[model samples]
Target: MPPSSSTTSARSSRRPRRRRPQGKPQQQPKRSLFDEVGVTAVDPAPFADLGLPARLVRALADNGMVEAFPIQAATIPDALTGRDVLGRGQTGSGKTLAFGLPLLAMQQGSARPLHPRSLVLVPTRELATQVTDSLKPLAKALGLYVREVVGGTSFNRQVDTLRRGVDVLVATPGRLADHVRQGTCVLSEVERTALDEADQMADMGFLPQVRELLDLVPADGQRLLFSATLDGDVDKLVDRYMTDPVVHSLAPPAASVDSMEHHQFLVSATDKQDVLARIAAREGRTIMFVRTKHHADRMAKKLRAAGVPAGALHGGKAQNARTRILDEFRSGATTTLVATNVAARGIHVDDVSLVVHVEPPADPKDYLHRAGRTARAGATGTVVTLVTDDQREAFRTMAAQAGVKAKTTAVRPEDAELARVTGAREPSGVSLVAPKQRETPRGRGANPRSAKRPDEPTRRRRPSERGHDDGRRGQASSGRGARRGNRGGARQA
Candidate 1:
């Protein structure tokens, strides 16, 4: 006979509630920040079908962008529907348009002075400028104004632009922080915020400033983060900020473009420079990455002396000088660019057929970014790293970590294989005169003291005298103490 109901209840109660198997309470596996639904491969979609404004579609067509890239097609739909999106694509995957189209489409009305309706935060000034340029035409089609705020440019000009009003503001984390601190800009009205190259921003120690800026936006504002990789601090950002974002990944974490080729050319230290100069004299645009600014400048001089139209780009050059050099490169006036890591991320030029690493980068990410300079937009390109006996092991390890299995070769300055692989050719023996620099003066009075005399010929400085030249000199002014402080804060921010 079954126990009476009351008796059963009393017995169940008397049995000490089954203890929850104590000791740390069986920690549930952590949930991922993204609830990732399967994103199947999507074919290119026409701009009109993506729910974009008719004017925007026309503008895209005018720009010769009739169909969307894979990344653009996948993200634009969800982004237009007002959902947070996490996009991962290799460099040169047309990510700019993916987030940009939706950002412009969501604007309802005019923005107030100093308060933009949309914001795009990038890692560097070059990227900020590029993003602004990319969106300006589209923004105009939608009757929106896009402004760029970054360091190495006029702070007062940025403030004035904000005062007039802006619809979209593209900026680096530091400069944007400086603007917010100076009361020249406000973020409370930002309805959409996109972080391009989010992983690089995190790597550059801008995560704190990025977080601070993001916090100022309303908690409910839509966030769209596009990154080449989604590990480490990037994961932290997604967990803290994104709300069940739809994740779309078009490539693996490390960038591996199908049209890109990687080669490791082993050479002796004595022959490395010769091999590099030969590669620099290649027929098409080539970007050679060096380890230091001094090295970049010196290498450019050496190449110029060899009759290679090479320009140096690094943090050591003034902003105007950097811009001028990059412009020359883009216009085909300069055939080669010898740059430090500064140009690895934002220097996007068409027909860059070759990328050479004069020295191995600090790590795998740098290697990938440096290589990404070429093989852009589905174009075929080659990446060759000049490795000596000492660097082979390190480079091999980095390659393994970066998911690359490059073809190894033993080559000398005169090897036919080198010519076949890299288009190595002898440079003309005519030394080209370094162009005169007329940089935009950073402050008042034109810095007469720092100007070179017209009669004086340019001379290369000794490495010992360089002493870590990072392009900071001649930036401060006698009358602009506040400006100086702001600039300093940006550099350190």
Candidate 2:
């Protein structure tokens, strides 16, 4: 309605302001980085306040592990509060302690025997051993007993230990499934269960066994799953098994290229053995990786013969032997170890200063894993690849794809650079006896000059029968023979 301007202005000024529409309260823009990465940051301070037993906290402080990795910080509070957690982090990012500490702290003073209160399922026996190693001391400090159940060891012994009772059980799915089938161990007592490296187990095709084992545990029990990548079968396991689990992830894995120093040495096949020997002679501990088990054995033997104290680790060896060799290498009883791809995973040793790829791996993943053995726990290291002419392109391609920048050099046995890089010292006065060469037996129609000569008749032939060209037959053959004769003749002339 058209009205006078003054009347409309007065009415509008007198009218109360229209009420603003109330919309849903805006969520502080979900944190951009974590949301973008599809993960959540775990805060560490809350864990300190969560009623953790004093002894365990003291042990943590004593070990200088006061701070937690992102995974640990995120999962510990929920785990201690009795909530299931699904943690995803890269290898070697301290997942063991993140789960281990809380489980131990919560289960303390519960003297349950012959049945495990907590179960940790890993894919390989080596990883089981490693997990047990990391948790054993902490468990001891908290008055808990931990037992390992893995294959390639005495089953009777493990069963006997289980009969005596354990608070924590670290096992592989296969062996654990066997024990459960035989009714030798009861999963009903398990209050907390962890599947460390779940993706790796699934990748290794142990998902069926892992699923069966999970089925044995109580449905309402706390379940913790940790893995590097959670796609494919691992995701299925999480969806089916874990209930409303808190998900935590750490920083994206370090780029293998920028984190390591790569070196490529150009050496003739003949010089490769000597150069490797020199490199193995380095002062600090060194790990030399080869392609096959046979090559690993042969190369270790050769290095030992060349005055390098070396050992070999491969699948062919007994588990005890493998353990002993690894122990010796880690304790500095031996400074060098020659191994195959079997040692690339589930091997953790300290103070390794160099990683030498006697033969480069076929893929960049293997290369990165092999190199990772050296630079660990935030330590500096060097990685060297011995590249022959045939492998140069492959090495270059792998380096490029892996984003590694390598310095190429021609290496020799006595080169100062080799010694400098490997920390090899000049020998004082000792000399190694070269292996003796075997003599070949003289065959029929062989050299008479070198063999004992038997008496024989000497006959003279006619010039036509002798053939003027010394047994030449065809014209093309004769031309080639004549060129060879001319070369000798020219040399003599």
Candidate 3:
């Protein structure tokens, strides 16, 4: 079934080495690989010095960002000059303002409801919402309206908002693609575009759709791309779309990883669940990560039953429900948020003191993102990964790949080290007063096929067996159909 060695060699030999045309003239190499390189944080740099409009500086001050973070200080200057920029910064390195200010400043012209002048594309609905929220104050200071265009909410509401006009549009790629497909969003008028979390976008397999959306925008428009890393995939986007981008990296890709404290807890298989319950029930808002949505849900439910104000978040939640859960977490209404990897870049709330991995991630990058959520913007935090005996070797390999030398501990629920590392407390016996209602993500999937063997075909229904259809418009229903229609109407009433 496999090709012989000789045949493989013959195929390789037959393929000629590709060469340039003999008569073609050699062109000058790119003058600079990038217009700018490695600008570190300019700490204590006031926003006033970044050449931001006075009103924006005032808005920043009112929002308590009187001083710009290092990444923003390094990039705001280049971005404001209308130079195409490629930026990578540590997690919570003030990346949003790095590009947001420039986008609001350099972008020209007003946006009609259906045609925004500036666009920001993110990979998830939560990020889209947070980005819009972060930029709204500045946009308001500038007397401009910025709107979020994402799925998981009413399409008509977004359409209506676009009709009123959107100066800036923050969106997730998939839903934006759907809007583009439906002819609801027009991008030819766009003068600027910003892509946030470039690495996550690539990791989530959104680059294909991101590329298509980029193609729809004007070719000459200014672009700003930011990520935590600049790898081959991100480099592909730079090569294809960005023109002589001024590259600025505040720190290495794993810059934030080094700032957090890493711990590996080795507990017995029987004690794992109890240890986790104690951690989730700990004081201070904690984020617990699981390997799957079901695990996330089941774990959250267990914690809630144990009296921890916990919530579950995964891609399977309706957009509104996701927003509510995140809102509660941010507002401190819900103290513990348990989720899968969906919240990696999707969450950006402040004051998160702990990140617990109920299960270790399969990749080093995921570990970094999960850890990045805590200890953000210069605050120190702890990252704890629980490993049973069976997962020890696997987790060790994962930590090594993630450049983490975790401090190992063999602990039970009452171990002092566990409390010291995670602020984990004894499980409370009180039940959660009320549980937050959850709505499953929109739409139901088709039923699964029967488990019976293929040789055993499912029984078929005869024409008359088709209930109401047999007496009416032959499988089609209209207003005149009274059987099931009455049932639906009665339910509505």
Q: Which candidate gets the maximum lDDT versus the true structure?
A: 1
Tens-digit per-residue lDDT, 411-493, candidate 3: 99988988888878887868775554765443232111111111011234575655643555453455547667898899999
| Candidate-wise lDDT, in order | 0.83, 0.73, 0.79
Per-prediction TM-score, please?
0.84, 0.71, 0.82
Per-residue alpha-carbon lDDT of model 2 for 1-493, expressed as tens digits? 8999999899988969879999988887333222345756555553455566778877777767776766777778788888888776644557888788877977845535557999998876667889898888888887788888865566567778888888999987766766777777888888889998776676567787888888888999888888755657888888788897877766442334344577888888998887887777778899999987799888877777767778888755555666777887989876889987667755788878899998877866567667878767667788999999999999988887666788998878788888777775542223333233332222233222212111111123478855753554366577979999999999999
Worst 10 residues of 1 by lDDT: 449-458
> What is the per-residue lDDT of model 1 for residues 1-493, given as tens digits with 9 covering 90 to 100?
9899999998878967676865777776554433244333778888889899898999999988899998999999999999999987778878888998998998999999999999998887677778889999988988899998776666777788999899989987776776788788999999999999887877767788888999999999999999876667888889888998888877775646879889999999999888888888889999999988899989999999988999998765666788899999999999999998778886689999999999877589899988998999879999998888999899989998998878999999889999998899998869987899886645332222222211111234577545433233433433367778889999999
Candidate 3: pairs in clash: 41-70, 42-70, 113-162, 113-165
Instruction: Give candidate 3 misplaced runs (Cα > 4 Å).
Output: 1-41, 255-259, 433-440, 443-493
* C-alpha root-mean-square deviation, each candidate: 12.1, 22.4, 9.5
TM-score, prediction 3: 0.82
Instruction: Give per-residue lDDT, candidate 1, residue 27.
Output: 78
